[model samples]
Target: MSEDERATAEGMQTCWSDSTPGEIHASFSGHRTLCGKPVIEANPIYASRLGDITCSKCGGIAVFDEGAARTRVREVLDKWIAKGKLTPASATEMGNLAIDVFPGRAFTSRRKGHSWNKISTDFLLASGAATDKDASARFVGELGLAVFEGLQASEYQGKY
Candidate 1:
């Protein structure tokens, strides 16, 4: 079989295992290549070592999340709080920007009696590269295995 055909066949055969803990097989993250011809992204960092996920049209970082905006605003608010930089009025203004700039993009979900959000594993799994049930299951299995293996490795290192 040809290379692409062979790769596809291999991917199809891979299965997730709940019992095992090291990457059982290659993940979609490792196996699949982005489709279409790639273009040069205008991002300052993109001009350097661009990865496969770079956008084909604009050569942008192909951000699935509003990570940059969130990080910047968070850092600013944190810095202001650290330096006692914000007056009551200024704090209110920056706080407004913080809430409005990345509305609905917050990684954390509101919890009972809590003002901040927590990470959602469900959201992450849902947004992964795999589209179908089977593919997703397999990917999750392989990922679980990888994580388990890493934990074991770390434990072993600590013992030595």
Candidate 2:
């Protein structure tokens, strides 16, 4: 391979395990698809192409912190609830707080369930965890921290 190609390949390898800024940005451009289905289609083309903003990896848009918000809020919350550090009522309260804190960004449950909620990244902006390029990175870092704390609390001790 050419020198530049070899260098890029090496860098890509690192990003595969621990993504870099450029890699994340580049990867974000491609839509996630699987089994002839797209997971995350472009918002604009979603309506015409895939009919929705579903993520090919998760089968749905995954909202914000549904499964992999990078922040792992749900996982942390689940752990806290499991360990008795947080109650379902409290978890619901946090979800509501998230909604109240980020009015338009919070995802509200349309169903008749008390556990339904929405996710948004507005907290990242509001908390100054990120401003531009580092927003997602900061959020992911926070998610890692949440997971760490949950583990420390013995909630997701062995589940991970």
Candidate 3:
């Protein structure tokens, strides 16, 4: 038999055996019922990770780095407040919204081992704040540009 066929046969045999050594089996025999009705089934995190549930639609398997996102959001918000563009309360609210909405982690290589927790343009669409999708994207781009400008200005001031 071919290697694939042999492997399939072995797997089938393993499934049929009652006591397979070095194999772990899932047991739901002791599940509790709610008022004589079957309770909803819920899998553990490891089970979900092992299954095909780690896709982007399911939020993926990335670790959340809330600290980094919070810091960046606070920095941007503070700069705006100092510039008189945003009131202190408004800055706080926007910073809270950003922390709540954006993912605190990403699986991109551009982060270089650091967490990619920055807010994305798609967040505007997801949060229903974008009347026009293109405009929202442009707004996010402009926000990024503004942050870069603020960084440059800070660096220029620090040089003196």
Clash totals in order: 3, 6, 0
Off by over 4 Å in 1: 1-64, 87-160
Candidates' C-alpha lDDT:
0.30, 0.31, 0.34
Ranking by TM-score: 3, 2, 1
Q: Choose 1 or 2, whichever is better by lDDT.
A: 2
Candidate 1 vs candidate 2, TM-score winner = 2
Q: What is candidate 1's CA lDDT for residue 76?
A: 51
lDDT per residue (tens digit) for residues 121-159 in model 3: 344444444545564444344444333233222221110
lDDT (10s digit) by residue, model 1, range 1-160: 2324322211222222233333222122323222222222212232222222122211111211123333444455455556775555764465444333222232112212222212224333554524446644543433333322222222211101
The segments of candidate 2 whose C-alpha lies over 4 angstroms from its true place after superposition are 1-73, 103-160
Model 3 gets an lDDT of 0.34
lDDT of 3 at 137: 49
Best by TM-score: 3
What is the alpha-carbon RMSD of candidate 3 to the true structure?
17.3
Q: How close to the true structure is residue 127 of candidate 2, measured as C-alpha lDDT?
A: 55
* Cα lDDT, model 2, residue 146: 50
State the displacement of the C-alpha of residue 77, model 2, in Å, after optimal TM-score superposition. Answer: 1.6
